[model samples]
Target: MQFHHHGYVSSDPRVEPAAGVGVNRPDELPDEIDVLIVGTGPAGIVTAAQLSQFPNVTTRIVERRPGRLAIGQADGIQARSVETFQAFGFAERIIAEAYRITEMAFWKPDPNDSSKIVRAARTADDPTGISEFPHLIVNQARVLDYFAEFMANSPTRMRPDYGYVFRGLEIGDGEYPVTVTLEHTAGPNEGATRTVRAKYVVGADGAHSRVRDSIGCTPYGDKANHAWGVMDVLANTDFPDIRTKCAIQSGSGGSILLIPREGGYLFRMYVDLGVVPENDNGSIRKTSIDDIIKQANEILHPYTLDVKNVAWHSVYEVGHRVTDRFDDVPTDEIGSRTPRVFITGDACHTHSAKAGQGMNVSMQDGFNIGWKLGHVLEGRAPESLLATYSAERQVIAQNLIDFDREWSTMMAKRPEEFDSPSELEDFYVKTAEFPAGFMTQYQPSMIIGAANHQNLATGFPVGKRFKSAPAVRVCDANPVQLGHHHRADGRWRVYVFAPDANAAVNNAAIDASTLDDFASWLTTSPESPVVRHTPEGADVDSIIDVKVIYQHDHTRVDLGTVPAIFLPKVGPFALTDHEKVYATDPEVDIFAERGIDRRGAVVVVRPDQYVADVLPLSATAELSAFFAQNLLPQNASARV
Candidate 1:
């Protein structure tokens, strides 16, 4: 039997899905749930799945959708999102089932005559080489199904339920403040209502969010004004770029985006509504799939377009819109105390699907905030840490809009509308960073302090995620990548990068003095994030986990000599195994390639795996302060 990310075997007989949730009435729900996720799209599933990692916190996810879509909207996983899936231990699964996007071909009319269409440019899909995982195109429904399966096997025993409609949102007086009134829509007990209360509520319910409206939150950006048509078809076409990711602009008709989907001979094509001719009577008319194909034929000109099969298609308006903040402010009003309500994904922003970010962004929003909420509800982290969710994601949301506003305007126009070729091509070149989801940088918050980091690591700077690099382990002499270091577990990783100790005193992983300093902090730092949040009588592993990677030849060093932290121990009273320590000095040192040295640096990585801060091993006080700013001390009351 093969065990997956959270350790449930694929063939496990004990697996129970969301349908196994034992709630048949309002009283059946736990009086206080840790989280109440209001939507079942990419955002809700990712959020619920992430929250399931923390055994101390309970999560309840309810969706209004009657069932999963057989043919859903939004495909194409960005490189950063693929890194996220790698963290979840499912990227390889999706990558195997999805079509890899290698290069994008741009088509435009020749400048001389404006009548002939030609391939203007062919560029590598990921020119920056920032991530090992490339962008991929797969069915959106398949991705959600994987999430559902992962949740079923999770240890938390909570799964998302569909056909449950939220009728009202209110703050009730009790341990759980946020009350969600729900009713089953199409199930056997139709119209049966239940009140589920939670400590926190997240509204990922799309642009028309009922929770956002109830909270008095409003969108503060651009309104949608354009509509586009998309179709998934198996086509018989003479066009050279039929099987490739191509954007073609015709002289007479509007532009079309042809992206090959997973499986053989299937492609999703997006066409501007301007391609469909308007009725001479001047009344509003709906565009059909045949009309889209006709416009594709007109755009191709000499090349023919014939649909061999049609899977699914639709016409929807696209726009650039975003909200001021992601979280709702608290007031003296009845339900706004401990149970705070927040929104993410489409609820916070809406944009054109040109960047293929609709689903990825939604999932990422869930990934970013889920752990933070878990930490707070479990009393491990200060409530102040939650504010960073709004600060970080809102900026990303704005950047998304600014790019979409420009990209959509450019794509909707004809070739003749542009002054020159350079102008249009430059648009694609300049906007590469946003869609790939690599350039997003968060502001300084409680977690990442302004006065803490002085000598940040170059390349992998503080506040940015650690850049990916190829490495090899010292223990097994196996290769590894730096970006794949994290799992869904809610623990911050403190990486001790030390030089190759030619010899060890008492068989330690590094030099005696550095090892002593690290061991002292790891075992007994009062202000350590892991130590600080530990309950008075509760036995829990420290919130921090220590990992060591040396910059020396793997052949020369002793891998088994690492400290007790790297090894497996029976309970708290057994011999430690030396398995977690690794080496990057095997071939060409990965540290050297990434602008670090054998002298080494102590880098702090957040639970989300973003680089929090860096320091010399001797600066233990600075390290202690880093945790004090984010984590709450044991027996401490709410800071808010």
Candidate 2:
């Protein structure tokens, strides 16, 4: 499928028409800036958008090319990336523009011959548990356009100084800042050079990053020599069954995936440039439009080959490497300390385009680091919080790289030529049945939902398997009261397990008579171990609110009941049928099963919704200390 517009606004009128590098750049560049982003790709744009959110921060993005966003580099938007968009208040816009793909169709050739054309499987029919925006099908350029608009609303705006070629950087501990030189590509100011000065810099530059090189950071991993050609087009021809993500590996030549992007199909074909002789020169320069269409059709199956219009297309090699270091540091330091200057997106890691992790990973990287940087720069968070960026994100990136390697290997493996004795074909067939995580791992690892529990006997069991926070069910029939940032307020909310319990009994239990009695008992009884406070004017519906729970518990518990009132704010509140037990501790296993440690009465979660510090029940002082260390003065530790 392809799309062709008879006439459109051409940003580059005097198009030099060079593929990667080796194009003449613009002469003039920005003179001053606080933060300079190196690339104008998704990563670069998203980073600029995020950085622009800070009122004090000055950001400018540099695009080497003089055009709009790429047509179809990547399409899949993982669950986590959706959550991230919500944080920035643009998830809805993205979802509206993109197609919601509930199912992925996987097929092979031949019914009887299970070796090569094994079987077809799909996930569309399965139930997706509790999510509004399940999946989407927007292109990379449109996503960037959304971000560009969002950034425009912010104090710091994105200035599109296109065709600016990066010369080099002047890095030092002293003043003068980092100097970035760029030259104009066209017009009277064409050969003019301009220098930009910024306090901090970001290298959102692509895999072969000039900014990365200037910073002395080295990318780690084996280089993939193979190149793939992708023909992104818009066509009227219909593949009724092709909904969102589709894989056609059983075709005449090899694998051809027709992902249903917005308005048209992003037809990606895995071409072996090494084997194909004509691909050597990298010059489709003189090839007519018809010839290009023919080439694309030949690459895709002949049966499905019918192209009327070609909107945009590009062929490029893949970068299959994860950089060991994102920013340069003194070799003399000898420790993996944080770099004041950080690089993210493709600059940090690059993998095969098969899983479409490129843009997604880049966006996640920005989301992960952008907020942290904002807080630290704004003095809302401790400086030490910045260190957590690499520690958390590196693991995520490594896991994704591992998944891509497996996916790439599976696609490269020609099971048709192999023997049937090993049951290897069965493995691939089962892989088709498994979740998308089995192939991409990035989605499952990064996405909050569908995660398992981590098994740890000691300390704050920090691993990938953290239970997702329950979000406000907006679509549900029940009129549950909801609030802004219901998902990411960094509060351990507790709900009294009174699900549909008798309203009369519930009222009787908390009304004037019983409330006063309970409060008196809590204060006088030596056995009472809970704090006491009033839940006056609180939202008392069955739906849980941390503030409400804390108020109710504090109102009921008496002063002398338990010598020291265990502050509900900094300890695990028991929720069990076993009832209150002052003589014995609550069952640790019960809390552990719920993925919270009972021993650490207090578990502090980061604002991004990940566990940060866990405090033991025995040491209430440590809870105070945890707050002192984890939060800034703005947090108002007294409130916690």
Clashing pairs in 1: 171-335, 474-583, 530-543, 567-577
Model 2 poorest 10 in a row by lDDT:
576-585
Model 2 over residues 15-104: C-alpha lDDT tens digits? 212221112222334466556777777777767766656655556677777766666467767555665566556677788877776666
| TM-score versus the correct structure, for each prediction | 0.88, 0.67
The superposed Cα distance between candidate 2 and the true structure at residue 252, in angstroms, equals 5.4
- Model 2 residue 613 CA deviation in Å: 4.2
- The clash count for each model shown is 4, 25
| TM-score between candidate 1 and the true structure | 0.88
* Model 1 C-alpha lDDT per residue in residues 1-640, reported as the tens digit of each score: 1123233445644353222232231323455687889887888888887887766677878887787757878888888888888777688889998999988889988777566788998877877786788889999888888777676566575567777787778866667888888888876878898887887899988888988887777788654455677999988888988878988888875788888999958999888766333332322136788887887787776788889898988876666788766877743332333338889889998988877888888887898898899899877887777777877888888888887788878888877678877566676666676788877766677776452433434666777766777767666777878568677667777877775456442465545467656655655666544456656543333466667777666665565565555543422234343445677745556766766534566777787777788776777777788788887778421110
Question: In order, what lDDT does every prediction score?
Answer: 0.73, 0.49
**Regions of candidate 1 where Cα sits further than 4 Å from its true position:** 1-32, 111-113, 275-285, 330-339, 451-456, 500-512, 527-530, 534-542, 568-577, 585-588, 634-640
lDDT of 1 at 605: 75
Best by lDDT, which number? 1
